[model samples]
Structure formats: structure tokens, C-alpha cells
Target: MTAPQDHAPSDVPPAPRGGAGPVHSDTTQSAIRQSTSGMPTRPHGDDVHAAAGSATQPTGQADWSAFGPGGSGTAPPNTDEADRPAFEPDRGGTASADHALAEPQRVRRLKIALMVCGAAVTVGMGVAIAVLMEEASPPLRVGVASRPTGSHAPAAPPAIGGSSGASGAVPGNAGAGAAPANAIACPLPGGPAACPAMVAIPAGRYRMGSRRTDPDAQEEELGGAERAIAPFELSAHEITAGQWQLCVNQGACPPPAQPPQSSTMPVTGISWDAAAAYAAWLSQQTGQPYRLPTEAEWEYAARAGASTVFPWGNQLGQRHAHCGQCGTLPDYAGLAPVGSYPAQRGLYDMVGNAYEWVADCWTPSHAQPVPPAQSACHEKVQKGGAYDTLEADVRPVARTHGDRATPDVRVGFRIARQLQRTEQ
Candidate 1:
């Protein structure tokens, strides 16, 4: 082995020395110094080095000169040993410090997630409250005018209480140019030849509705209330087909569904709005407050101071009015001439002929009182029975209702004028 060179094998131990000697190779000494550079100086450093050298040595010959304190391969002892702690692996301590430093970041991340979740929940509730406010509004109304053309024909005799004069003028004509001192001549476009007669109703108070104990009283007619009425004038008979035709001719009102079967029959198939429009047209033509009668006034006038169901009596007589089975019509008991029935208080067909529209809103029962002043309403009140009505419905107190825009052949209306104080 050529004298085994000068270096010993790295895994071998030196032979027993007479005094202290190096026990490790240069490479092993360098590794130990790098690993324990930050370790504290110990009183037994040489002994510890010897023990490390012995533990790493293989079971063979090796040089130990390089590991000695003054050997050329040895590094200088660390001078910052006192300022640094010993090289002890602080696994638990270092891990705890790292965890402490990282804890706030984890908590911050957790808080950010919570805030994001909370914000998401709050935005979901604000969208639900805006949808409920748009569904509570009322409806609107539209009006259209329609009329048909024809020649002015002779009107049949007015219904009961109507004047029989050939001039076609109402009795006591006293408007614009007339004779009666207490009445104003109705402003008819055709002069006295185009209008029906009107009756002067005196101002007074009367029981307006039916008594609750009355035999055939409906809940809506059971209040038996008394109303003080102002003096007003009413058409003697329901508006005849000839009279309505004059309105149509003047282009002030719409034409009926069919031309008058006879000029004497009451005009039918009219709606409350159409009737109101007619009254407005008449007001313009006559320069008077022509309108529909109030419910209370209509009932009071129809009763004619009689406490019985019909104007004549409690018993329904065939000749008393034109209802379903109680009319004088021969074959079919359909609509009859306006004056076919008897008159009460100079007014004709107060109980039967056509269901008349009044100037009051509909109420289910008389128990609930309506305000006296007029206002907009969806449904309107109708009074009196129609030619097609049953006997029980012909009572002066019988009541009915319909929508403001509805039209029926059995329905019609008459005009009312507020009496001037002088006229009254």
C-alpha cells in the first residue's frame, strides 16, 4: 500500500495515544463544527468531541490528528456562543411561536368570511317588500256617444197622470214662455211638441223605507226611516220612446236598442250613466237642475203617503200595475203603455213599469246608512218593479241594485228637477 500514504482512512480510529490527540478526519471535523457552530461552549468540549469521533469511527485504523483543537483542519471556535442560545431543536417552542404569529391571520381570514356571509344574507330581504304596493288601484271609465236617424213620429199618450192635450206639452207648461205661474216650461227642443208632462211634488218629510215587520220586506228595505225631502218636479210618466227619440234627434243622447214599439211605452235598455248623461243634456237644454231622484225621495214619492205595499193598498191587483201576472195586457204580459196603470199623487207607474235608477249608491241593507251627499261609487240603487217583475217586487218599497255601467231591457229612468223656491 506504499506505506499507506500519510492520511488515515476516514472511518478508522487512531491507535492509542500517549497524551491528547485528534481522533477524527478533516471532513468529519468540518461537519461537526458546522452542525454545532451555535452551541454553547462546554467545559467537556474535548471529551464530547472525542465521544462523537469514537461513535462515528469504523472498526479499522484511522487518523485522529485533524480533529484536535490546534489541527489544520479544525475551524476557529465560535466567538458569539454566549450571545446565542444552545443549538437545541425547540420543536415545541418554535412551533408554538409560529402558531402564535399565524393565529391572527387565521382569525382575520375567518372574520372576512363571516362578514361576506352576513352581507349576502342582508341583501336578500330588501327585494321582497317592493312587490306588494302596486296591486291596490281603482279602475277608470270611458264614454262614447251613438245615435240613429229617423223622422219625428207621434208619441203615444203619456202613462198614467199624463196630460191628454194634443200639443204634446206637459200640463202646466211654464218655462221660457208658458202660462202656469208656479211652474217653469221644460226646455224641450221641439217646443211643446217634444216633451212629456211633469208633476209637481210638494216638499215634505215621509217614511222612506219599508218597516222591518212588513210582510215582504227585504233586508235592504227594512229600515222604515223618515227623510225630509225638498220640493222637486218629476215626469208624470216614465220617459217615453218618443221623448227619448227627441233627445236622440237633438244629438244629446244615445238611441235605444230598438225603435219604440209604440211611442207610449217607457224607454228601456238604458244604463245609469246613459241616464245621467240624458239628465245632463236636459239640464243644458232646460237651464234647470235636471237629474235622477234620490233613493229616499223616489221611495217617498212612490208611496204617495200610503203605508201599504202598493200605492193603492197592500193587496196586489191586476189592474193596479203592469208586472208579470198583474197587468191588463191581453195575450203576453210584456211591457204595456206608460199610462196603462193607475196614478198616485199625479205620478204614473210608481210601483211597476220599469226598474228605475236612483241617485244613490247601493247598500246591502238599510241598517247601514249612506251619506246624504253624492260621491263616486261602483254600484247604484234602483227602485220600483219592472213590467217583467213579480207581484212581490212591485211593492213601492221594494229595492234592487245594479252596476253603474250595466244595461238591461227591464230598466229605465225618469227625470227630476230641483224646484226653485219660487216654483215650490
Candidate 2:
């Protein structure tokens, strides 16, 4: 074996040796391919041989977790040259010609990395559906705060007029009080004093008026006119024509062909069925029932609880109301009694000296269940509206109409009730 050390091997092949050619020894690649297939071998040569030094096999170093065969996922233990085994077929190793052209280029780079992860999941689901369609749309709202826009100004409307703070209409103190016992009888059939004189009002919920109808006191221009109204109670006065001659002395009020020289003045030209038959003869001589207030309960009882429109709020003049103010009578010329006009609205000739009558019953405007007194068969709603009307018709829901029979100095009526049928 020592003699075999006279080597020239690193797969020897420099060619042209003496005394017998064709002897290439890469150790034994199947005996050098069975002694050089078909001969004419050119396994390179070595002149006299005996060069010595190619007996390797001592390459020590292999710990990649003892590699291959044991765990099986192959390839790590070859440590550079542990007897460098593989080569043969006359040692023509060129790394097996680049691992046979790199196995189909690793299956074409794994199908181009799964088509670039499915087009990045279809462009991130089309940008999350365009941010959920801009968060589902619809919301314009500006005004920075409202009434035209921001910087805060617009206020001021009060001196005697303000209401409609909640906006339902007609509770200007529907004639001040009394009401709560109606099993039915409001027919006023002929009981002379027909109705009125109930008065107590109280349970509270005010601030009515302002559905803004003063567009220069309107002939019909009508723009955003939602004049509001609240509070409630009124009638503590007016209905005088000598108190409808005590219902024509009780023939159930039919007499006034035109009498009344002055029972202290207040009643006027009559008719909401002669002021609901004199407030149903003062609610059947005081058993308590009454009726007539729904122009929002007569301006929510004429702003009794006060939010304004003339219980001394928006100031219409005549010092505050008696029409023509200090213009010294005659303009509306008649009616005065019922506390001669003053309580701003807490009571008294509502706001002037004439236009009374009002247990409601008309609606070419106001709107609500309020149409009962025979649905305008002729006329019946009236609230402070005359003295020829004009300082914005003396507000507090100012309105007018007549003919429940006729009688006129300017027309008069007041009183209201039905708080679930009056009597308490």
C-alpha cells in the first residue's frame, strides 16, 4: 500500500505515458468505464508517473445536524471533500452540468409566485370598495349654527310679542279659566245668558304667538309665516251689549235688533251664536261648563303666562292698546268695560276695545281639529282684530269673523273652557 502512494492522481490524465498507453485511473468509475470504452483513450497523461501526494480521505468536518437519510429532507453533510466521491465516467464532473440545467428553472419560479399573490388580492378589493362609497353619502347641513349662517345675530322681536316657542298654536290663555265637566250640553239652545264666566286657567304651558303674520299685516303675500303661539287663558272680560240684554231677558238671546245704549260697554254687534249664547248662560247659571277658545286657545290664553305678542311684549301702541292709543276715542268709537283694557294680556280687552268673540270655529288659516261650530256655515271666530284694525291688528293671534246671528258695535265675545269638559 505504501508503494501505491507513488501517485499522480487528481483524476490523472495529462496523457502520453511510455511502455503501454491508455491507463487513466480516477480510482474506479466503474473501472474507468470498462477500460476506456472502445479505447483510443485520452485520459490525459503523466510521463514517468511516481509523483506522490494524492491519497486524501482525511477531510474531517461534518456537523450539519448529521444531515440526510436520518430526517430525510436531504442535502447538507458533504464537508467540502470527504474523499470527494461522486465523479467517475472518467471524472468529467462539471457539477453535473449545472444540475441538469437547474430542474426546469425551479418550476418556472413557482408559477411566478402564485401570480403575484393574485394581483395583490385584486388591488386590495378595489380600495375597500372606494371606502364604502364615501361612507354611504347624504348630509349637507350648514348655517354654522342656522338662521342664515353663523356669526350669531338675528334676535330682537320682543316688546310685547314673542311666543310660538314650541309651535302648536292657539293657547293664548283660552279665556283665563274654569272648565272640566261636559257630559255634552254646549248646545246653548235658548238659555239666555248662553255662556262664559268660567275663568280660573292655571295648570301652565305657555309661550304662544309669532306664526309671524305681520308681513306688513298681510293682504296675502305670505312667506315663511309660521308665527308660533303658546301659554293660554283669556276671557276674564268683554261680552257686554248689556250682557246681551241678559240673553234678551232670557228668551235665550234673540232680542238685539240693535239695542244696548251702554251696560258699561264691551259686547259689540254680537254673533258667535250670540257669543255662544252668552257663554251658555254663564255655564247654566254657574254649574260650570262654558266654551270658546281655540285660535290656539286664544293666543294660549292671551300670553297670560307671557312669552309676548302683546301681554305688553311687542308693543303695538295706543300706549299698549285701546286702538288709536291716545288718539282720543271715536276711531273704534265704542266698547270699553271689561277692565277698560290694560293687563297687557294677563286679561282685559285682550288688546283693544272691539273684535272679541272666540270660542274658535274657523280655519281658512290656523288649522287643527278646531272647525266644529258648524264649519263656517257663516262666521264665528274673532279675537282682538278691530278699531278698524291696523297696528298689525293688535296681535295675540289677531283674527276676526262674525254672524252667528249679527249684532254689531264692533262685535264682542270672550270666555272658554272644556278642559276635558269643565266643572272643576
Candidate 3:
């Protein structure tokens, strides 16, 4: 079977919008619905437990037919056990044996006693039944599936990748759901207005940061920062040109979607403000929500499950990345559509090509010796080192920040929207 996970960047260029027209204009109106159907149920554990309990005891299923439809002239004597549940003794009378009881009088006394005892036994049985009903159900336990005595291929387990032996949790969550912001600037491979349609990254946590021994860990490459970064989410691909158009169409940003994007290329030419506006617009349309990933999330996704500087691994491979390739530097002078390189960071163009914007406002978390006279705020960090420089420009922790309002030729962005609600 093919492995369930593999993160190789796509080299495909922008696509034409001819297939599906743009997504709906208002994303906020998109509703997140929960089912209104009745809750599903399985047989209660107590029911089984009660059945087993009754089996152990001598009590039988209730049957009333043996007495006949009406009292029969001929009847069998009552069994002693019928009165086993009740015990009562009659009080001695003050005028006992004063005279030999008459034949009818003696018989009448005996019949009255039996009648009283039968009534008491019936009531006791009813109370016992009620008590049995009140006990809690039995506990549930999962057991191994029954396998045929002799089989060829083994059965696959239900959990994800079947890695963990335990049954994973039934998928669901309770929540109304999700938003927030920042102005980030990135250099695009192309001008703004032509970014392509972006892929939806289902909301999930991913690991980020890198291990030592990476090129960035070397003396020459570790130039900007040193600190531990938390995990976060990122868009599957870079922001597309058409997505930016949605924000402009809403009248939030001045520039409209431009010409170059065929619908699949990464978005470019947008300043940080434009990207932030698109995020807000998307949230409102879903009637639910959306937001850019935190800086931690962005890097986590970029790492693509790897602890290396790039998603592919530590040593840079020319064919895998687009930056400073061969004897020549491949910055290429402009944004070249998203996914322009597959071997780069397990995601397209991550190493070089275009510096992508992140959600954090310009600032440094642990920029080494720490900025002496200033706060970490006021300067943003960028990832996927860009072209137009030595190889150092592409280290994972590389940092830089520029005007949020102005677009840069070498910078671009991708958009991210969070899920509205999960199951309970």
C-alpha cells in the first residue's frame, strides 16, 4: 500500500479559472450546521446485565395462563414456594376452642388465612422486580475481532495509519468557531492581482522548528535568530492571485486581481494590508470564520513534518529548490507562480523564489543576543528565503519586515481559513 503521508512540493503553474467559477462572494454567509436528528442509541448495558441476573435467580418469566381464564372448579393445590417471599403469623383469638368449631366455621377460617398469605406474596414479588430495574448497566469492553482460522492477508486496523493500537477518538468537537490578524510584507515572483486559487488546509496542529546539523546550524548560516518556536498551521499552498481579487471586490482594498494568474499560481503584488483584509472577508462569508496562521504555525507547515531547515531535508539540493541553483542564483527576478519547485521544502518555492508573508506583526521572538535598545515588535519575520542573495537568505528562521502597505516584486502571500465547527 502507498504510504499515507508524503509532502513533495508541486511544480505546477497557475490554472485557468475556466473549470469552477470563483468561490461565492460572501464567505460569512456560509453556514456551519449541526444535525437535528434524534440521537442514536445502542442496547443499554443494564438490559443485558438484568437478563443475566434473572437467569441466575430461580425467578421465571411472568406467565398468568396456568390459573385458567376464570377460576376453574378443579384446581391444583398452590405450591409452598409461591409464598416464599412473604411471612406472616396470625394472632391467637381470646375465645379459642370455647366450643367445637362448626364444620363450615372451621373451613372458613382456613380459607381466609390462605387468601391473606397469597396476597402478601404477590406484593413482595412486585417490589423485588422494581428493585432489579434500578441497577446501572454493565461496563463496555472492546475485544479483538474474530479472525478466520486460516487467512491470507491480515486485516487493517481502524485507527489512523493503524499505528496506535487503541481505537482513536470518534472525530468531533463542540464549538461555534474562529479569527484575528497582522500586516506582513513578502516579495512576490510576479506582480499583484494574478494570484491563483488556493488549496484549503483542513485545520490541524503541525510540528515546526529544526534540529542542529542543518545548514542553518552551521557557523556561516546562523545569521539572524536563535529561539524555540511553537507549532502552528499553514495554508497547503501559497495564496493565489484570484483570492486577493475577492477582497478587492468587497471594496476593502484598492487594487483588483491582476492578469498573470491562471488561477493556480501563488498570489503576489499584495501588501500586508490586502492579505489581512482578505482573511476578514473570508470569515464573514462562511457565517463562521477564518484567519492567518500564527508565525509558529506557518513554519510548522513549512517544515512539512521534517526537523530540517527545509521540508525536504538539511543539505540543499539544486533540483529540489529554486534558490541559488547550480553555479547561478535562481531568484529569477520575480514571483514565478506558487509550487514552482517540488524538491525545495516539500512545498513549492519555499526555499527561494518569493518571500512569503506571515501573521506576526514585524518583531523578533529571540533574535539571539536580543535587540538591545528595542522591543521585538515593529518588525515582522518572513520565511522561504527569497532569491537575489547568497544561500543564507533561505534559512528557516530568517527575519525581515517592510511597509505593510507597499507591495514588493520579490514578495507574495498565501491565505488560510480555519474550520467553523467540529462534531461533539
Highest-lDDT candidate: 1
Q: Give me the runs in candidate 3 sitting further than 4 Å from their true place.
A: 1-214, 217-233, 256-264, 326-333, 343-346, 365-378, 387-389, 419-421
C-alpha lDDT of candidate 2 relative to the true structure: 0.40
**Root mean square deviation (Cα) for candidate 1:** 45.9
lDDT of 1 by residue, 21-58 (tens): 00012222112111111111100001111121111212
* Candidate 1: clashing residue pairs, number: 10
- What lDDT is obtained when candidate 3 is compared to the true structure? 0.36
lDDT (0-100) at residue 158 of candidate 1?
A: 40
* lDDT scores of the candidates, listed in order: 0.50, 0.40, 0.36
Residues 1-424, candidate 3: write the lDDT tens digits. 0000000111111000000000011111011001101211100000111112341333443233343334331233334444523443322331222222343354456557766776687677667764443221111111111112222222221111111111211122101111111212222233332322223222334323333444433221233332333322244356655556565676865562234434444555566666667777655654434566655555544544444444544554454544322111222222344554442222345545455667666532233433343224434444554332223345444434445555543346655545334589
lDDT accuracy of residue 162 in candidate 1: 33
> Which scores higher on lDDT, 2 or 3?
2
Model 2 misplaced regions, further than 4 Å: 1-237, 240-243, 246-248, 251-265, 268-281, 285-300, 304-306, 309-313, 317-322, 326-330, 336-349, 354-413, 416-418, 421-424
Q: All candidates' TM-scores?
A: 0.56, 0.25, 0.43
At residue 285, candidate 3 shows an lDDT of 53
